[model samples]
Target: MPERKPPRAAPLVLDVNSGYDELNLGRLALISGQKTVPPGLRRWQKTILTPDGRPVVITCTVPDDQVVPHGLDNDFMVGLVNLCFEAGLPDGPFTVSAYGLLKASGFPDSAQYYRALEESIVRLNKANYTIDEGWFMHGPHSWTTQSFAQVNYLSYVRSRSGVRGTSVITVQLAPPIMESLRAGYIKPLDLNFYRSLSQPLVRAVYRQLDALHFDESTADGLVRELSAPLMAWGSRLGILSDRPDNVARTLKPAHDELRARGYVAEVELTGRGRDKLLRYVFGPPPVGEYPELALLLSARGVKSGVAVRLSTVFPERIEEAARRFDHYLKISSRPVANPGGLLVAMVQRPEDFAELPGYAAADARPGPPPAETPAKGTGKGRSARQRPAAQDELDALEAREEAKLAALQGQALVDWVLKQLTLLGTMKHFTLPERSQLAELVLHGQLDGRTVVREATRAIAGGAPAVLAVVEDVRRHLQVTHP
Candidate 1:
């Protein structure tokens, strides 16, 4: 009789506290749709700083669904794994907590839990996913730290059948290891030294795959045959080793490992394996596929560009409509417009109010003030005595107006900040100079701060047309200072 497979392990609940609530769950919610988040997963309000020092919130949650046989089915599990890698967690040791009602739901083997966890880690790590922290537990006495630590640190996890499982695994994205892999793959290719060939290889492979005349019946044969030539192409590009034997040996282990993990099978590529290979051989999917913009627009109930365009046209005297539009573009996965061309056009013929909706013709005739009657017994001399007192009142009113103007300037600064947050949801990669300039633009009622303005100008111009909208906004705000 065939050996019976052990049952799956119960779902392990994970709670990540990255020091920011937005970074925690809001960011996740932005990336993964709210539907994927387990029902009853409470998002606690909190704040944490990104590597770049921008403040954000952490998303907190508790598992609500029954543990699935395969951990991959759990959205939270996958999200956390992706987050860890994206946050560069593997560079150093870090600690996170996992708590939930643990019961043997599927796998009877107590060791299955460890196996599943380890497999997840390894799969992520081998895919160049970054994680550096060791797994630890401070729970009941039934769970021993020493045993868990030992099992967790192992490079691979073994299932009950003694076959190494690929559910979880962890590996360091150290420079030397990456260099070795690149050298081994690229050395045979006679191309000049270049750091990355994975992308070119992937594009070539994709084109090759697309051109093949194989049906499902012959797809397997095509894949096998094509792998050799593709490998040769990679070798010629200096992405593979010059030594044919060394290249074969190096690639064999990866093929075998992927095969064992069910990422790749004997005859056809599994969906999961295909995705992994695409990322590994290419890179992360393009920004056009980023989920945050989709989520924001969906949640804010924006069905089309009408609302956005209206907001851009009329910012309600608070935020600059153009700037807000630019913010939307920056946070959006959409490509940005070219700055040089836009600037040239803007300088050549500035946009007129006639082009904008809701712009009415200015009235040419002035209206007279209402007529005032003199009080009884009032004369020129008496009016002169009253002149000083009247002047004092007028002076006081002028002072008050000045104060209000200053206050409005302060508020504009604050509004600018809020507008930025609305655009760029907390991500860790913005530069310090950029942040400082953003803050200044809010407070000073100006975007023409020489260095800062130049930076903002570059940012707005480098990408989509939406950025131009933002540049226009900044220009309008700066007008207040100039006029």
Candidate 2:
């Protein structure tokens, strides 16, 4: 028998999606270095400039019942997102045990830790944010305004023995972040390296630093050197003190830890007194965001841009496809004329390569094809008094959609939902939360996909507001019936 290589574990890195990373990078203070939040610090607002110096207002509110997320909440948030990727990035709700979350976050899975986890989750769930202008939409590659809770919803069900036994938790990630994640606006963070630091403050600082260093527009798509004024740095890291000396004192231990770990080559405080600026020269970045997959693709002569783009956009599928392609290349009866092109094709359409063992997971799971565009001038001359469609036409449309629903797999709900919105002429008017709610309904089987499309089509005559009303009614019905 030929010697075979052992299976490799997926990389232990958190793929921090864009806009959320900016929340911790100083636009909003989601993480705090303080062990306990000050009383009455429920709402805070700040105005910051975008990369192009456009002013944006960010407002963050913590519910009266729940405290602002602070301390170890950062670890929990990071761990939860990492778990999402590990589970293949399900687009809807998923269950994970509370103990599993604790372990993944580098905390001991004990009663106290479990309690801490529960409270942190609550805080995260109730935290509401409104970004008047700085939310980055990766699909459009533009900045826009947005409002959402940090988490959509969370349910905790404990076993009979409560803290002594396992407890399963269901979490729904917020919509805008999910959209950005799917759009591939992600940065890599070595979770193992993050958890290795001794101090919570150090870990928090390092998380922010890692995000700060990943600049997609830069030459290598990384900022090797970073500089910030002391006061602003404190705000970014959630350091409680505003005094220059106080901030410096609090940051010293974290700075020392980062330097000792060799992640930071040097940390310098330039200038004098309150005007002091802190600069960081970081050690080399990890190979590529998806190192193992990148290596396999590069070895097969794949171009760097193509490899990175595919890997970023399809992190879950690309790795599996690449591994299968590797095995196929080794066992094929004949040589591939263009190995790079072949691998690229496989990654893009894994279902076509299902005969390969590595692509088994992707079998029968083709992504939805792009929606067809209506020809120009087809609906261009319609007046405000015009009816969207005859009642009989809508009935036929509903019947056709109902027929399609029986064959629809859960993965296509988002696209199907978008199609309905597009038909109603309300796609641009719908908020992210509204779109997410409609998708979640179809995904969880709370509402039939056909009903969504039917209602949307029927509401078209009344314009976007009417379509919005139908969505709200569906959501309310689900809440009352299911909750």
Candidate 3:
């Protein structure tokens, strides 16, 4: 008999904290359908001085300077992000079908559309980034980091192909891109509604709103439903200007439609003179303000005063408790006899969240696919949506880092990083996080791949009693022995 594998290390269980709504799992790009294809080699660069005066610079380049990608690419990237999370960050070439891409993106399957897919791939591959003095986590140890850390996406295009061919493309994600998806700093989006919205600006506005964080308390100690501060143009959409006159023209249309749809409790575009901005608030879901909380109660058939006490006595613990509940569900293979009672206990005992089966000890048992997912963007390759209102802060942060990278001359540094990662992945069993630590070492051209790998292998096998200790040993060895 074939040796039974331990059930393929059941895929990691995801709760609200690690899955679904907690993250806006997509790449950043303009949702607006820009008809103009950038003609030649296109490049963008920006630089910023942090409050502490550390300079961060970014630079990016794309093929055919005039035909920069817009919503089409954004739609394609969002589909990839979704795949990474759903597949538990599998070592890629994530497979996608051509028909699926067309359906998700609303592109008609035709020769013209096929060409569109071909161009998007070229635009993506030509895209590159460099950042000097980067801020985002480049690695667990530290290095010269590449701005476009995500691997360039790969796909196949053939002449006169539509919905008839194999309809499959394999996507391989870079270390940085995969890590960002795994990070919880994301928000939820309803892609179904996104596909239905025909207007590009509407999709743009939707991504903006969906990205706002849910803070129960204001900076002034005032409690409120939700609030977000957004810029009118510029980086938010990667187009137009934030100038006084340019702020309202295109945005007004999106603004009106958004409020009319009841997605925003309040979305107002108001700013004095050249400082145009938007303040958006969220409305409750259909069942009420806190649908997840409410449903859990209704399931347990709790008493009427329970909600009031929980809010009054332990208002602070509610959100964290809910997160814990989710984490609990992720680890526990069995159902709880009393979920409501368990939630209440969590509220009273918030510290217990850490004790739940988590990163170091999470059950990787495979489970069914997420229930009721929206169709994948246009077969294996395209997407179209008015977009959702959720904005990913991580995306925003990467944008900042990428912008700075684009402004700097750092190709040698970018190449060194690519080499280290390529070698490590090929030769070592280091986890993603572990690889990140090793990545930082590449910053100043410290150690060659062979040396680093030898150190890691030696430290891991050399009597370290635990994983954390082994990691620490590697870190120590790099600092003292290597450099």
Candidate 4:
């Protein structure tokens, strides 16, 4: 058989300080544009044995700096010896060369230093830190010019003799994965959006109560207390009526159902009613109104009639009641005002009226006879109390309802605007060219175009879009064969 060329010498592995420079050398050599590796040097290929006796191939460039001078500095010689030893050829017939001066400096023979260096090299190679620095001259003149010269060290040894092949496995945890691993998960609420909707609703209700001659402080207090549950109820039922009359009409059934179900009792114009009204005017309520309220009120039963009476006797109590009732009417007028003055009567104690002695008996007496007014001819000094302008009252009520509707429409528009801005913001993070292509695709109905447009319009109208963009995107991107 023809003599097979002795398996090419194993490629050199160099350990160097300047990783960037070494990497640049390899890159420049490939392009053949610059002399990163010194002149006269060329790449070579070789094979080594795996631990399991399989052959592994490697390729590397040979550099001039590997030749150590005969009498190099002890430290430099030690380093070279260590490098060769690490290549699995510690006891050499291994060639050593260096730049002119280093070769002239005497080599050191410190067994301890040599041993420690060898151990370190073994550890470094095991850690996969071996790197090659292209060859260059190794002399004081060369060092000053290039700072540090590169050296390539190759080894040839019996099969299965040294460190073998290694495979690295990497696992990357994406943001969602990391977040899922956390102890507790929560989505942050947009408080600014919450407040923007809430503040106006509260203020509008307060103004309405003020128009009805209710005390401001009392109206504010009542509105604040009921706002939360009311909004929750509205959200649940998806009730977004603009006019108070329509709101009342829409919610009356829900209120009646809750009352009939015994989840809520005495659906009076009290705290519970006020809260429901506030939520209706502002935002969507909770999923199921009765169940949620039942959970809240189960622990605390309704206030006693006696307690209600005592509270009403105080002028402050009457003012508070008026304020609460007015606010409810402004937002939703389902719980009508107490027409028979029952709330006022409940506040008065028998003893307080006893001071008047005959007051109770007089109140119990038969109704008073009708009073006679002066005829046109009599011309009495006093005139009858003028009736209110029905037209004017109706106009005022209509204006108030229109304002509320406008606010709802405005909020819907704002929400749509925010959604559009979010989509644009997402697109901005893409690479320039990619973003341009995506924009074009959006225009051509190939991206999130229709879906985004639909969502935007739905947000503004508080209604579903006529065209479903997500469905359209699915049809375009993932063609499906219909049965």
Each prediction's RMSD over C-alphas, in Å, is 26.2, 16.7, 19.5, 39.6
Residue 170, candidate 4: alpha-carbon lDDT: 9
Question: Candidate 2 vs candidate 3: which has greater lDDT?
Answer: 2
What lDDT score goes with residue 18 in model 4?
11
Output the TM-score of candidate 2.
0.59
lDDT of each: 0.29, 0.64, 0.46, 0.28
Residues forming the 10-long window of minimal summed lDDT in candidate 3? 1-10
Query: Tens-digit lDDT track for model 1 on 1-483?
Result: 001112111112222221111111111121211112233432222332322234444222222332111122122233333222232233322111111101111122245554444444433332211111211112242111111111122232233653221122222333322222222110111011111112223222222222221211231211223232323333322232445445444444444543343323342222331131221222221111223432333233332222222122122211222333334445556654643223222222233212334322232243673344566677445555676898999899888865653444342333323222223221112233233334445455454323333344456445655455555555455455444
Q: What tens digits encode model 4's per-residue C-alpha lDDT throughout 1-483? A: 001112112222223221101111211111111112243434333332221223333333323433111111112322332333222321112222121112111223244433333332222122111122222222343211111122222221111332111100001112221221121111111122222222222212222221121111341212222222343333222234434445555555544543453323434332544344432221221112123322222122212222222232132233333333334345553654542233233222232323432222333444663464766666542233222365578789888855653343221322222223223222222233332233334334354543554444454444333233432433444333211
* Model 4, runs deviating above 4 Å: 1-317, 320-385, 410-483
> Which candidate number maximizes lDDT?
2
Ranking by TM-score: 2, 3, 1, 4
Q: What's the CA error at residue 414 for candidate 4, in Å?
A: 10
Preferred candidate (lDDT higher): 1 or 2: 2
- Pairing residues by index, what is the TM-score of model 3? 0.50
Query: What is the lDDT for 72 in model 3?
Result: 69
Residue 41's lDDT in candidate 2: 77
For model 2, residues 1-483, the per-residue Cα lDDT tens digits are: 001112112222233332123233323445675566687778766565454457677777886876667788888877776665544445565444455567667787578888788888888898888888678774455887888876787866553545321344557778876665544455555666777789778888887777656654554445778887888778655666768999999899999989999989999998877899999999866454666676667677676545554564456676677777878887888989988879877775565676764434533554664444555668443432233465568889878766665565553443344444443444445344444445556666776766666777788788868888986777686567557
Output the TM-score of candidate 1: 0.19
